[model samples]
Target: MKKELTADSAAAAARHARYGTLPERIRFEDMTEEVESAPGGAAASYDPEGSWKSYSCLALDLGL
Candidate 1:
């Protein structure tokens, strides 16, 4: 049986068709383009406790 193609798999196939594949060895210097970073030190001093809030148990509600 043939497997179904997911959205991610389809996108990956399209990308592979367009750009082929990556080289065996990727260098850090090749990816040294300066892109826009997070505002100041927001990423450095991120409060994970405040961000990752607990969610309701969906599995229990669905009786799984």
Candidate 2:
């Protein structure tokens, strides 16, 4: 009799195939994360001149 694979089992098999098995001591649920947001907000924090200067191109083409 062939046993049908469940969604969770299929995902677990694929994950093991890609990354191999992880150590038992590591669990994602036990982890804590901290994130800090920009005080001026994302759009207000943009430096257009600084960004454009970083790009290496003979001309800035927008394809317009």
Candidate 3:
């Protein structure tokens, strides 16, 4: 008898071929409204180069 291939089985085989194991951990985090709005606020008023540095430093300060 010929066996039929399945989407789930194909995906699992591909993962094992690439990584030697299936992925086991997954996590998700929500972005806050304030964080989403800050970039637009900064870009409107500040130079682009300086704004990115300032933003990166702010993120580091917050340990994000």
Candidate 4:
């Protein structure tokens, strides 16, 4: 049988990927450059919550 993916699991995966086993190692210096719209437009941001209580890549794609 195949297993289904859930939002909580996705969020955990994101957090883990950023911090790894040593969450304390997370540093702003290591973060990606802020996203901005155009050359001098407002910058984009990412939520540690992965954008919601349950992260949905589709929703994020639509700018939800």
Best by lDDT: 1
RMSD of each: 16.4, 10.6, 14.8, 22.9
Rank the models by lDDT, top first: 1, 2, 4, 3
Ranking by TM-score: 1, 2, 4, 3
Model 4, residue 25: displacement in angstroms? 14
Show model 2 residue runs off by greater than 4 Å. 23-64
lDDT of model 4, residue 61: 83
Off by over 4 Å in 1: 26-64
lDDT of 2 at 9: 97
Model 2 TM: 0.33
Residue-level lDDT tens digits of model 4 in 10-55: 8999999888885367678777687655863433554566657765
Put down candidate 1 lDDT per residue, 16-62, tens digits, no spaces.
Answer: 99999887886899868888876766677777787645556789669
TM-score of 4: 0.30
Q: Candidate 3 has which clashing residue pairs, if any?
A: none
TM-score of each: 0.37, 0.33, 0.30, 0.30
Tell me which of candidates 1 and 4 scores higher on TM-score. Answer: 1
For model 2, what is the alpha-carbon lDDT of residue 27?
68
